[model samples]
Target chain A: MKKEHFQENCYVSGHTACAGCGQSMAVRIVMNTAGKDTIASNATGCLEVFSSKAPESAFGVPWIHSLFENSAAVASGVETALVHQGKKEGINVIAQAGDGGTADIGLQALSGMLERGHDVLFVCYDNEAYMNTGIQRSGSTPFSASTTTSPSGKHSTGNPRPKKPMVEICAAHHIPYSATSSIANPKDIEIKVKKALKIKGPKYLQIHVPCPLGWRSDPSQSIDVAKKAVETGLYPIVEYEYGKLTKSRKISSPKPVSEYLKLQGRFRHLLKDAKALAEVQQVADKNIEYYGLK
Target chain B: MAQAAKLCRPGVIAAYPITPQTHIVENLSQFIADGELDAKSVNVESEHSAASCVLGSQAAGVRSFTCSSSQGLILMSEVLFCIAGMRLPVMLVCANRALSAPINIWNDQQDSIAVRDAGWIQLYAENNQEAVDLIIASHKIAEDPKVMLPAMVCVDGFILTHGMEVVDIPEQKDVDEFLPPYNPPYKLDPKNPMSFGLLGTPDVYLETRYAIQKTLGDVLKMIPTVGKEYQDKFGRDSLRLIEEYKTDDAETILIAMGSVCGTIKDVVDSQRKQGKKVGLLKIVSYRPFPKQAIKKALDSAKNIGVIDKDISLGSDGALYSEVKSVISSDKKISGFIAGLGGRDIKAKTVEEIINLSEKEENSCRFIDLNKNILWEEFKTI
Candidate 1:
């Protein structure tokens, strides 16, 4: 631990993740916090495709990518194997996936992993939609946001459903720890990841990672978009321990949902429809009241 | 099967319950509960997780195991290919059962045959004793550094899985000596960091598959050597690729796999007792298909009757087509599809198939079909 020696990045710069990619930033922070003694089981998504392409891998730690919906199960196996080998003392196992891989297809395996009480951290990088598949609607896609599958038209206002309560669902599993953070707050993400890795059971950390390509926003504003989401009370940064809320980030002065929506093209149609705009505002208002974000 | 797996001393066992595969995992659970075996047995949520769990454990350098039945095998099919492509030496027991539309849970070979091309070594057992022997031998065979691939020991559901006989479970000390602890060449270790299951671009993806294909061909030679070594140690000759029963001097030979081979052997014995030139050629290794051994076994036969418990739907029996591909063009081979959806392939059915192969050269004949019900159903089509 010499002060002069710079800490080498676990996630290096050569990865093909797009510029200002919120998921890449979140992954870099998480990996750096977990450090070199970590093993990561990644689900098939943007992170896996961009980081581990043939002949070149961006990971500085032991990394494995299985199918789309089994990272939790695979991490459980990795933890069990390490325990079996008497090597579980200092190592950390982390399972990571996108929103679709977590809230939708991967939910069953994640539930199983948590129920089994494996000592691993499961991270869901919430990018809103299936950004790797060119922006399709997912369970985590917000209400009134237009994607390729859920397009806004005269008859419809994009995705009819609100974002899935993923952190609440994970908290319902009665795990040791579960939390929501954002790429805009890498310090919080780093602290939560470090804390979760120290607990003795499954922990969930869902990070709000805005995709510039999918959101049709400027790449430079990716962190700004994520910050606006938290400031508007739409994506409340919160934490739960043993199915009970322990903490939440308060919005000192809550901004209008329009400020967050106006930055991204996916929500452009909502501005044209007053009813849809109000509905979107209602989602943020409800979150603000429920989690006491304001 | 559970005793054999326990003897192999797998560091991890993960499985989900489905039909006849349940008993195998249940027994393993009991062993773990009783402290008879020191292992981590994970009861996963589904067959897909069961397979993936073992894949993760095996990739982390522990010998892992899982078992499933028809639908469960199909559910685990994707991960089966992944485990093979990643070159993990995991062992699985496939209690073969019929697939559902009608939803029958009885014994059938259709399930294991369905995943023949998933790159796992597929071994079919004719009885419980052979099932036990194969489970133990598969660990050694699959764990060889030269042939590091996942293996499936396919035991017929309810037939070998549920049926009990006096099986000589090997001593744990002997099994340990026979099959040493699995030492993987590469693993998920922080001490020596490595990335596995990476996206193989066009430049490397094709060669990775080619390596597996080439290794499987090498496995065809290595199985007999391992089988002979096992026989030398255990005094049972049950792990050969194909078993020849009086095929040398027979005019007609019947080929089959799994527990149905027991019935074929019984019919073959009676036919030989009556001075008939009939024999049995049981397929033990179904995946590398045993083409050369099959070609050698059927060299002198005038007629070959392949009693397949599964079919290729539009074409013919899978085994019959494979057998036909290896043999000379002059050989008369008839495929008899029977015991589908767990319809009993009785001794009478085997006799009928033998008689039919002599007079006709039918490719996909459904034996023991109730013609009245079939024609009644066929009228609508």
Candidate 2:
């Protein structure tokens, strides 16, 4: 089961996370690819909660965890300080946060960092909902997905809004680099981090990590669920340079949207509602058209 | 304050534009642009980012600075607590101003007072000289090996920030000897890897707070030595937590902080000529509360009055509450809230405050208030 690409795993041992947590894997790949010369500012979330439990840390790299809303802003500070020491060239600064931190509370700071062109890489681990806060609906949550706060009932169809265009939002800032990545594609995760580290200005890479706890999916099926999300054309693995879409991972076997949704309990109610299921399929169809998925 | 920053030579300055606070950062930017200061300056998007920028740089072990006032201070309050809780020695200047809702942009201490327990060493400057001197001394006090907590020097918005004065600017070499380089014991280093400001479980969270509180107590003792050292080296008396102004043999004393102390002192001098037994006690450091010095300063006075430019809403002024807690005596100390939202506090107001305290029992008094206007609003409500 070993992938073609492997890293040194900057996110080390002695931590608490679900056995098959895809987000933790993404953290490992991103940081390892960022290398030993990286200093990180992490936001408060499951990553922060599990990695640091007082007097013990899972981070093998030099890291700092500030409030959830200021991780990117703090990274901007770290970058400027490196500039002061004439060490910006030698060190790489990275910001790590969950979907809630990136798309909602931390968005302003992220936009500011990108607009100001601080030489730092911002990595948003998009696990759909605020999984750490008991599966509350976040801006990045997919449409009709059942989160604790957005539960399906007689009057409700879970989240009414579609998934936030996080990568597009980063591109809108006209940053030097922006891309979509996932743990399912470990090669892409490492490749994007390597590419971002080489860029001289603000760059963003958002990895669509599947949360087994929030998704109510089988823990062992995390990789399958992540792979199915891409194969179904629901989550595009695309890259943008300076706001222009330059590259996208071609989907050769575009599975029906049901292949992805049927695996997770969050979307189980959609099976009974044909109209809602069609709405979800239409979203995947549009992504397939836009991304030119085969 | 900007000149003091220039002398201290922080590695980075992160600032956002806020009224009364804008000029300090503007000048820092101008210095960096003019090739006068070698530090990297960031005109951040908001006070929150400005504070985060400092947090980031300070974690990297490079000294940094930021400034804000009123709404800007409130915006930065979240990160203010983060900087202290993280145990980083960052410097922030609070150009003290009144909070909004009425949208006033005048001098008041409400903004800084609101974040009193944010774990920062809060110092108030009475005039331009103290503003300049305290800003210079802040780096030393905050960067003390024992006390790595951040410190904020609050200069009244418009009063010290806009009001010009002749300040004795210290030489760069002297400040260098005084502050040296900010070589923190621990820093964000790639080689010697470590995590900072990590999550504290309930097991260790209380101890972290206890450590900061104990370090703050250590600051009260260490800060005076820093001021004394500044005096010995530069021939200027600095670093006093509180300054006593003619309190000896006085029947009543007026205690205050920030620029209003100057007006109180002027009133005290004139009242002395009229054979009035009145004195002034100025609080230079508000965070540590300086209980010992406050007690010693107001010992001889039979009656006490506290002038606060900031209040704690339902309760009286914050200073009034703390002063009352420290001095557990039968002597009544009247609290007056005045000069709010940048309203003027003339010498006559100081005289009236002293006069009222001598005649009345302890209570919260509003100075220079238009009662008719307030009553009109009440009728409309």
Candidate 3:
């Protein structure tokens, strides 16, 4: 689809999102695709708090602000209502949550909604930490990433655990649709979203959205950083259906893990420590071999 | 005419059966099944789904109903706040029962008392007639445009809920005349689409809560008007908020809620015949607290004994503390914990408490204290 054909006017715009925030860009692009017929349920996070401050909402479409953990549940209720009333044809229900909201607090409700098979699209805009609450490490935060809560110090290393494989969790539910997309590739996101809309049951799409504010990178380098995550096999774009992995975007000449790590200050400490760097490379290789990205 | 006035209104009802509270759902289900009530009946899997079903249906601009008790209420607690916060005006019939520790199923106000801050308007019934009538009145009050909050008619489990009595169930025409079709401010209309519960930042979060608070606070004013309007048609003038029994010439009063009020009233009548200066004050509205009416009822009493079926843990009984907060500092108030976990709160126990209040020595006591199985003396057991 042509970029101009995508709705020029988005539901959320002219907000105080930091310059080149991947979440803000993804919201704009996704809402544009979702159009006016969408009722967006946003978890309490940066996107929700920044855009839809009451009396002055950036959204043109119907939007709900729900608790951080229950955006999916709230959207399920909304979808159930719409379906019961026989008004589900044109109206689309979309639940958008950040990494912390989706991967941590909102996981149970999300799982419940998916298991219940509500006809709603849940979008996890993964910026990798609780950015709205000041760069705290979340379940989606990568290993060796230096977040405020998981800071590297004399006594401790950065985040010690690997990022949770959310796509596998969604796939385990035997959901009709689950995909990993990225703001770095808007076309992939747009295609996955359109494909998800055609499915009859709960659909999940986790978009790799880099946050310059939280990732400690140059604001302009957000998209580049996101792309490197894909190219280095740290974040492979994959899709699944009926409990089976169906498609994956393969990377030609996959870069070493160091290429992705050196760009962000969160991973800067790992460069000086060979042990930490080796562990990071092991995670990258595991993701590459698991997704069959190469 | 009274039979016509008590007919079921047109709407959708989804419910589940819980112990002690099953009768309310059973009666409503029968009403729908018999073709007397023009409503859709959904037999949900659990109280949580029952709440969700009604909330969803109500959001679609349809009036809906559900009922539950104790553990069931707690199971549906999360969705209760959702329905109220969304301003859906859904009405529920709550057969108040004791919460689980030992898991005994019996009559008590503990169930509804635990959910006191859930933003739903709670109206307690003293008898079967009030149980049926209050359910009708709650629909009217909740659906009022000025007070678009969820309402629960709390009937004592097994006591008023299961106990059969002569209730004048109104006819369909009277119900239609009294309760109007639900026309929500913003529903899930495809043509005129709007968000129901949108996220708000610090810029507008406080205002949303304030709006709900103000609406709830102002809803008390509409209760009397709505109550009076119902009475004009039904010929029963039920108290809109709190009911006082023999409170006029009493030196000592027992303040309680739910069906225990009936037990206390019985105790009060026999005590009054013997020239005892004891009275009973029954709290009808638990949410919004009925603070002003509570203060007025206990204003002249020398000693106020509060009987609570619900414990607040770390503190005394929940209602006792709420009542104490409303009364003047100089007033002597006693907090007694009774009927917890569905333990029997007999009339004799209430009568003994009332008599004890007259002595002016022991202020508070736990009724039916099992001394043999005491925790302090249980090491050798």
Candidate 4:
């Protein structure tokens, strides 16, 4: 009923997440904003694993987990059921998955849900890699970020592929709402969720949650690292409504991507290579131009 | 079957186009479009999403339905296990078809049989009438308080899906009287919230699995009760776990499932006229396998032949293996692989198996398979 009630009544405490789990924090903000009248279909990921480990659960709201790739489909089902029971009046349906679940295994399902115009909010807690599966590289992993699957070895660098453009993909579906947020600004997450919830159709919110364990960032500076990601114009906080860009979190005092890269060990190797650092800087410059973050 | 679904009043129907299963969904879609069935029809892109959508709907405390076959079933295989594991009771109709590789789109038991281990209660149909009956019965069994497990009502691909037979589709009013409204034991309600389908560690993973297995074991007893209730309401008696025919003084019996059983029955009646003392045992329930019923049905037989439309590659037939394990008789029951890839199981094939069961020293036999054609490739390999 109230904004604070979401935090108090939705996702509760008591689980075994790592010290700096941005997925948990971003998810808490997302679920809390979703309020008490919400049912979540979660994909297999850090949030799914940490929040509700059998016999004990941190969730105060009703939640379910299907496969990693089918959360949107499952949520579509839940939404239909709610409407059938005439309970969709106040109930909010949310599907949450990690980066890999979203940009890779779950993309088709997400696209299907959006195209069907189902009233559900899909949240992708972008931790960059598969942290729940022991830090494997995922589709959401940034280029040159080290992961177990994409090691920065003598002969090779880390991931060579750029992070999949998930927000653009959501917009391509011509859905009612799509947004990018950062856990550093929990208010932004809360604002986007409130805005998206009121619009009745498929909505996507990709929150840049800095995973300290996966990214090799400082546990205490997880929020700070996330802030730097947005401040550097690399992870732009923007919103779109029905395919038109509506809002962009301005980069008034723009910093280099080096500042963001320095905070995480995943990009630690990039610091020494000027060519890699310039490549990462070019990514930031492109985002600034494309999103008008400047 | 579509009428049965309409009667049950499924809240959501996920329709994905696939062979054999397409006609069933098309009928439902037409019904919904005409306002005959008040249900949300989600035209999902794939079978995987179809399964997931139903799983979500059931988890959200409403009844839902979906159907598929062959490659579609294989596509849905992943979500099938998830629904069962999460204990969300779903009613899935699998029009069984053969797997591709010759890319054949025809009848066989391979589709549903392939997912036997996915933790759904599988019911085989002998005809279109039986298929319709099992649809309503499966919903009852799946929603039973004691048996909160998913169920699959399987009809042979084209044999029953394409074949039109007279079925007394239950009236909406009567069905409403029979089946209670969807009030899930645990639902995603904000008023009374609870977490579901959590990550299970090694300490509790096996325990969660054992819980489902225990519930499946519990289904063994509840199926007959539910079957009896469905019979009482619908006035159909043979929807029982197994359909037994003239095994009283039989020396040899033939065991099979789905529409092929109809042909087997015709053969058994003729064999009885010759005073051959042969019978047919049609297994209706495959999962929570009716072991006691199976043993009781063929208890008097001196020899038994298990007919399977789907082979398990290097092993024998899927049902044949299960039947052999539970028979309590000597491992002497012969396994016959027949009617694969939509190949018709003529009365002659049934007669051949009956004769083979009598004389053969228990072994696997590929009935009607041309050895010269099949073995030619084997010779090269």
Candidate 5:
């Protein structure tokens, strides 16, 4: 099918998401690219609760909402079922969850799905925190980022650890494709998603999505923040295939983590703490040096 | 005459072996190996995979089955909700066993009870016969277009699963007649392909859940019809939901589920001769929780007590809480926690519960509490 045909009106119009919700836009683009021949398994998170309220649907394609975890497992089941029915050809299975859902709650299921090598694409829209549940800190919540559960105060710092390296974890499974993308660059996300679809075995794509509500940033700044995340080398856009890092976005001079952190209130506390700021910079430098983005 | 049922009914049989539940997978594997069943038998590494395997298989528009026990069932907990929410009519045989800490491998309802709200329809079996029959019925009920939700059949761990009775296994032809070939309304077919799960915004998420709720509500209605059809095919009449035992004139009734119901029935019969107005209400279908039948069964009893083989930690028994919710309007039912951790729930224990219910005082008591243990006494010393 033509890419334009795949793009024709898949995600339902009139969603209840906040203005410039990165996850909403990411799902819309992904679903459109997935086309009509694709089945989606969504885990419980901002994307699921916001789009699938009772009596209404933001999905024009057939859809299922499992739990906070196990979206990949559910997607695997769908793939297996199709294979059993002699319908595995051309049909694509996509499992989508947010950072909280994938990095923390869904890690095992996602690992299992990738390890099993099912013909499916698993996407982790990394919004950092558990945005659907009042911004609780998740495993994907970055270091020095304040959340309801991991608040920054005199006694305690914000989330004191770097986010779990999910793409690396996916890579460890030796799947056919694993990538990290950002909503800041739709073309990049679309290219990676399209590339993932072509790979025979399981594919994983971690999409950096800025959450206004959880990040305590302006809604309209979603894409901009996501872009700054890439530019700052805090969230490098990279892809791996066959257990090897195949590609990464080039950045001649990476911006400082402070530039990315300065825009959000969740990271506002980190500005005052010189030690925490240094630690955050260390994380960014590590990502930039590790992915060779600079 | 006992006849063999076709194993071909299930398009996919995904399972992980646990005590008591080993037989279901063993038998299914045998059938598949022997070519008696034309299905894929996925021996999953974990119960989680087993449940997930069935979920994916079901979404592909095929009949699926899985089996698990206490820890195994608990491990499958997360996927259970997914199977139900995805509206896939997958069937599972949960061989009931005690939850751990002390680690008992015997019979109890704690495992299935932990997953009470996982959105799957749950059924309890009183005997090996019911275990086999209810499994077939579960497939029918789950696969029903109106009831496109996963279903679980709970058989007492060693009580029924290990205890092999002279079960009149239905003829494959009869079972086929009773349960037609499962053709899913929507499947992942390339020709008429569709998405199984999609991203939903808030404007539509509740609607998806409502649809699941509506389907489950519909399953409650469809279960009876499926059970009746099975009964017509096989000469055994199964109570599609709750089964009442001599409860008509009883002033006090003991409510229980799983294989314990049989033991409770025997106890009730012996007590009835002693002039005790005691009866037994065996909850067969735990989910789509037979609210009306439960209310009717316990409505007339002067004192009602629910014997729970499962505990909900700080709260009362899960089954007891559900029973209380059902009988909230008219009854003041007592909750009894007993026979946990695969502990032998002797007939005397059930009889004691019934006797306790008869009293105006001591209504809700832990039946088998270790009286020798006293936290306050220990702390003072």
Candidate 6:
């Protein structure tokens, strides 16, 4: 179990994910970081549907998919079983879910897993909406973004609410470590995962993974869009320990929110509505001011 | 039920707090705290997570248990189907209670009866002692290699779960001899990395369900052998598909499940003293339905009456409908809906059902209905 051993490709190729699928990229990074002695409990979303379809699997480690909203609970059970079997010394348990599963439906189980202090790491792939169900608006969907359920219309704009502060909510559980990473920064994700796994208690890491199908971005620009999201201070990459902010990624030469929103068709309608566009910019401004990212 | 599970030496147990089932989990936690049990007890946030937690532990190759009632069981219904579909031998004790809309926290068979088709072995207990016996036997039966399906032991909410009873709990060493450590055929292991609960494409989905259906067919034969083995070790004739009382030369037999059979047996004894040729047929296993065993049990009787604590709403009782599905068309069969929502099913009610079956043919009737409520609703209609 050296770090170099974990760098080996545990998430091998040959799957059905989209060409620039951010979730599958993040999963490959995660599984490689977790190494071969790890077990994954996957939620029912794009990652599960694409990675393990029937007799085919992209994972080299043991993996299980129970339901859409019980990944964290299932991971907790796996960790407890390892302890009961007296084999919890060198294994890592990780539960991963999509944005909708994390911020909305699976929140309770995640909270229970954290509050009970299970030795597991929970990862949330923040793709902004329910992309598997054709881009329905979710709690984590950004403000003024067009989704199937929150399409722009005469009576209303697109999604009216801002993206939920899921990392803050998870940090409020007083877990040992909580951090936010992005698919744009693979090294940062690996470092944060290694750091979180060393704490010996429940840890939370939410990775900002762009969805090309749902966000309607260019297939090859997933990393570019994710980098712009972090550069614009819309998706802050920060770390917390014991409910206090320990580190925040400083945005050098901060970009405007429009630079990030223009790359995705979901926010194209906001470019015409100045007021809505300003509201979305204000969201980025508030995050930069609060997290001291600039 | 908690004591029985503890005796079985489960590796992991998880449960959330709901009425009637609350005490079972509490007792289990106490066992863990007192060092009497070496297990991990997860105090989950909801019944959904409770069921999911055990499903995970059991899938990881360990014996696991969970308990719930009423709305809690309803919340766990989604994961219950997953546990069975994945073919995990997870054990659950359902303290049966009524469903909501009126929100009654009382005794009924609706909760467990509602999820009978979730692909778990459904066992109904006649009393607290039988509930314990069923819990122990469920693990052995569900963990069998040929029949690796989840099992739920159903007990009446307040009547069996809340009531105190003198039960002959088996010793831990004896239970150890009865149920060995669960050796899962497949598991989430690093040494042998295999995936579980994968998506079933159209080419493979039908065969997966057909496999469970075929396994349950094997379970129907395995349950009685397990019950006989349990009796040989425990000295009690419990854990059978169905129990017969004085049905040999009887002309009328009243059929029911759960604790109401006690009242029916008492009524049968008094009716037999009066030379009425009355008998009782108690159903224990409800999921497999035991069509052959039930049909054979009602052979000598001329009139068959089925008493159900839960109804199917538009149709007759769930038990009555199943009984009618099996027996021949010529039999004088009747259905009686009784003891719903913790309503008492006294000896008099059983006597009324026995007398009603003698004259009624192909009728489903409701016992102990208030005439005033019926008249008021009639006028409104």
Q: Write the per-residue lDDT of candidate 2 for residues A2-77, one digit (tens) a residue.
A: 1112135577755798877889989988888888889999999999999888787777778999898999999999
Write one digit per residue (lDDT tens) for candidate 4, span B222-274. Answer: 77787788788889864577888888887798899989989988998988888
Consecutive 10-residue window with the lowest summed lDDT within model 3 chain A = A1-10
Per-residue lDDT of model 4, residues A89-191, tens digit only? 7888999898889999998998999999899999998989888888999899988888999998886578988889999889978888999999889998999
Q: What TM-scores does chain A show, candidate by candidate in order?
A: 0.97, 0.96, 0.96, 0.96, 0.96, 0.96
Tens digit of per-residue lDDT, candidate 2, span B1-381? 898888889889999888998988998889899999999998788999999999999989899999999999899999999899988999999999999888988899999999999999999998888887888888898988888999899999998899979988988898888888999988998888779887887888899899998988888897788889988988766578898899988889888999999889899999999999999988988887789989888888889999899888888998888888877587779999999998899999998999998987665788998766786755443
Q: Worst 10-residue stretch by lDDT in candidate 1 chain A? A: A1-10
DockQ of the two-chain complex in candidate 3: 0.23
List per-candidate RMSD values in Å: 2.1, 2.7, 4.6, 2.3, 5.1, 2.3
Which digits, one per residue and each the tens of the lDDT, describe model 3 over residues A1-294? 122332455454567788989998888878878777887777889987677555556666666664666677657666766764567788888888998889897787788778878889999999999999899999999998999999998866699899999998998999999999998899888888889988888999999998998898889988899999999999989999978999999997889889999999999998988988999889888888988988
Candidate 4 residue-wise lDDT at B235: 92
lDDT of 1 by residue, B1-381 (tens): 898999998889999989988988899999999999889999899999999999999989999999999999999898888999999988999999999878999977888888999899999999999998999987888999889999999998888888878989888888888998888888999878889999999999899999999989988998899999999999998999999998999999999998998898899999999999999999999877788899999988999999888988999999999898899988899999999888998899899999999987989988877766766757453
Candidate 5 per-residue lDDT over residues B1-381, each given as its tens digit: 011223337777778778877877787788778887777776555788788778877877888778889999999898887677768888887888988877889888888988988888888888978877887767777777777788788888887777868887777777777778998787655445354555555766788788887877777787777778778788776647888898998888889888888889999899899988889898888888888888888767878888888877778888888888877545547888887766678887887787677665332467776656757665343
Better of 1 and 3 by DockQ: 1
Look at candidate 5 and tell me the lDDT of residue A81. 72
DockQ of 4: 0.83
Clash pairs (backbone) in predicted model 6? none
Clash counts per candidate, in order, are 0, 0, 14, 0, 26, 0
Give the distance in Å from residue B252's predicted Cα in candidate 2 to where it truly belongs.
0.3
Q: Choose 1 or 5, whichever is better by lDDT.
A: 1
- By TM-score, the best candidate is 1
Per-residue alpha-carbon lDDT of candidate 3 for residues B79-106, written as tens digits (9 for 90 to 100): 7887888888888878788777778787
Q: What does DockQ come to for candidate 2?
A: 0.85
* List of chain B TM-scores, one per candidate: 0.98, 0.97, 0.93, 0.96, 0.93, 0.97
| Chain A (candidate 1) TM-score to true chain A | 0.97
The whole-model lDDT of each prediction reads: 0.91, 0.89, 0.79, 0.86, 0.80, 0.90
Query: What DockQ do the predictions score, one after another?
Result: 0.84, 0.85, 0.23, 0.83, 0.30, 0.81
Off by over 4 Å in 2: A1-8, B376-381
